[model samples]
Target chain A: GAGVSQSPSNKVTEKGKDVELRCDPISGHTALYWYRQRLGQGLEFLIYFQGNSAPDKSGLPSDRFSAERTGESVSTLTIQRTQQEDSAVYLCASSLAATVVRSSYNEQFFGPGTRLTVL
Target chain B: GIQVEQSPPDLILQEGANSTLRCNFSDSVNNLQWFHQNPWGQLINLFYIPSGTKQNGRLSATTVATERYSLLYISSSQTTDSGVYFCAVDQETSGSRLTFGEGTQLTVNP
Candidate 1:
């Protein structure tokens, strides 16, 4: 694909229902990241996947939030028992490799983002 | 945790005018980047500048690693340039997780 892509550009769900967001990263990119943007605010890091393993999941808001990557391709972020506070735009990005550790920092290319609204 | 702060939270400019946005980080970072979020909420990479300066067309950016600040300059702005500008960084202490600023909302009028 030319760039990172995400599914279900807009999703509306009830407060207690669970929701899942999917991300398809750029081909051959081994590192993927997830972020969340609330209304009138900058994005907040949710998790980072270096290949299939997530080295950093510190930003996950709570136990309700979790993500998994399939090898180096697709990734899914699941919000279990969503709340009104979970409403936000979920963004996915991919890079050639981990930044800083690599000899050259790889720029992360982001997807169109999934706007999740919990009623 | 490193905190990112962006100045001029809101900006209004006439088309063909110029503007400058500023970003300051609380700690050292291994990488820094500037991104433009369009009205559609898609993030566009503008510059991957951790240090030094880079120019592309009417947009230019400069980062002073030692001073812990970065500046983005947009010359001859257009209505299409109106949107939100964000500054993000990766620090070794945080496993290089990208932390973003609150962003500056820019409005360019014709």
Candidate 2:
């Protein structure tokens, strides 16, 4: 089975430029998430999508960050007017389901990640 | 938001040695997972043990939900085991959102 996959393993962007990172979740995964990991830092939650329900945007650090998951397969995280502070590795993960009951036992499979470097 | 903490921010061990990594959370969680991020920054899922114990090859993990903590054990470590180990938890109130700990950096010397 194919694991989750992300595009443009590495991206160097000028500050204030926008960038779009893409993720393809495993077939049938009902839950998808985005996270950012800065150098020598832990991962910070960005956004999450569960089925067709409203996405959880509480974790998005600012309005410049937004994510969209089409159906239950592909997801894109876009950063408008990127800042140097936004430079980090963006990771995508997916699971079988999003409900707490099902998520209790379901392991989230992560993608290789997209490294965004804002200069 | 739930807080997650990992112990021994960094560790160095000779190959074949065994080590234990700990993760303590401030609140109850519905999901707890262990991940290994290799030198290349690829996150590999190690375990999804929110409760009880599970082992795979030389790695094993146990989570005591009631106690609000989990432990990951690696035995007979190899140079390839040199990486960062992270513990992430999804608090009951956060639905499926995972809060990750700072992670433990492990260095295995031959």
Candidate 3:
């Protein structure tokens, strides 16, 4: 089985620029999530998508941060006017389903992540 | 919003030893999971025990939902076990989303 994959393993951009990180979830995964991890820090929730329904964008830091998923497959996290504080590794994960059952929650798989550097 | 806390922010252990990691949450959660982040920043799912116990090889985790806490245990630790372990709780408030802990940085030396 193919694992989740992200593009542009490393990205270096200037402040105020916009960056888009893409995520390709595993086949048949109905739920996708994006998280950010700063150096020496924990993973911060960004956004999540379940099936064809609207995404849960509550974790997005601000209006500048947005994400979109098409047909329960690929997802993209876009940070507009990126700031130095936005420099971090962006991670993506996917699960077969989003049910909160005791057994299903344990199966989320993750991608390698894209390290974005805002210089 | 939920708050997650992990104990012993940093730990140093010798190979072949055993260790325990703790995670506490501020409120009830529907989904509780443990993850191991390697040096390369890849998150590996360790356990998704919202309650009860689960063991995978030398690692075991238990989540006491009633107490709002979870414990991860590693026995006969190996050098490869050195990494940051995080506890994330998904409280179904608006949607199923995870709130992560600050994480516990563990270093296992051979």
Candidate 4:
């Protein structure tokens, strides 16, 4: 596909279980981002991966949340021992570069998102 | 952290009507983009207008960077345009992590 692709459009998991959501960005895009949208809420930034630089995990709600990008391509967000509050839509987006001035952040394309429901 | 606010939390318009959504940020942003989340949960980038005005079809957006406010204009409303329109901004201080508005839920009635 030409756009970002996410797996497991919907997932139901036990509160104690762990879940991993995947994001495949457009081929050759250099920047990737992960965000979460709770019910009736706006998107909250999670992490950002740019080229080989360290990922900025400032928005990660807790230590239990971690993500990694391989070769500036596929990225995965893992929630360990998921809590009910973790239930929400996990969104993935990829951009061409950092600032829109020179890089045209317009490269950022969003995926359909994976809906996780914790029971 | 910068504060972002969107007005008219909800709006209902008849097809072919025009409407505007506003987003106000507490600080200046060099990066601002408008997105539309369709009913099917797809986030479509409407415009990456950080400043000035940009138009595409029936949609147009303007961002007053110095004033810290942006507006999205939708002309000729259609059922397909019924969805949540989000305004996201990235403060250079934040390193590209977009801070999004609560969004304006627009409903177009036939």
User: Using lDDT as the measure, which candidate wins?
Assistant: 1
lDDT of 2 by residue, A1-119 (tens): 38999998999999999999999998888888899999999999888888755468888999998888877688889999999999899999988887757344357889999999999
Candidate closest to the true structure, highest TM-score = 1
lDDT of 1 by residue, A1-119 (tens): 99999999999999999999999999998889999999999999999999899999999999999999987799999999999999999999998878545234467889999999999
Clashing pairs in 2: none
Tell me how each candidate scores on DockQ against the true complex.
Answer: 0.66, 0.74, 0.66, 0.67
Per-residue alpha-carbon lDDT of candidate 4 for residues B1-110, written as tens digits (9 for 90 to 100): 99999988999999999999999999877688899999888999999888899999999999888899999999999999999999998886767788999999999999
Segments in model 3 whose C-alpha atoms lie over 4 Å from true places:
none
Per-residue lDDT value at B104 in model 3:
97
Candidate 2 Cα errors over 4 Å, as ranges: A102-105
Between candidates 1 and 2, the DockQ winner: 2
lDDT of 3 by residue, A1-119 (tens): 48999998999999999999999999998889888888898888888788756457778899999888887788888999999999899999888888656557436788999999999
lDDT of 2 by residue, B1-110 (tens): 89999998999999999999999999988889999999999999899888899999999999999899999999999999999999999888778888999999999999
Docking class of 4: medium
Q: List the residue pairs that clash in candidate 1.
A: none
Please list the residue runs of candidate 4 whose C-alpha ends up more than 4 Å from where it truly belongs after superposition: A100-103
Lowest summed lDDT over 10 consecutive residues: which window, candidate 2 chain B?
Answer: B89-98
The alpha-carbon deviation from the true structure for residue B21 of candidate 2, after best TM-score superposition, in angstroms, is: 0.7
Q: After superposition, how far is residue A72 of candidate 2 from its true place, in Å?
A: 2.1
Off by over 4 Å in 1: A101-104
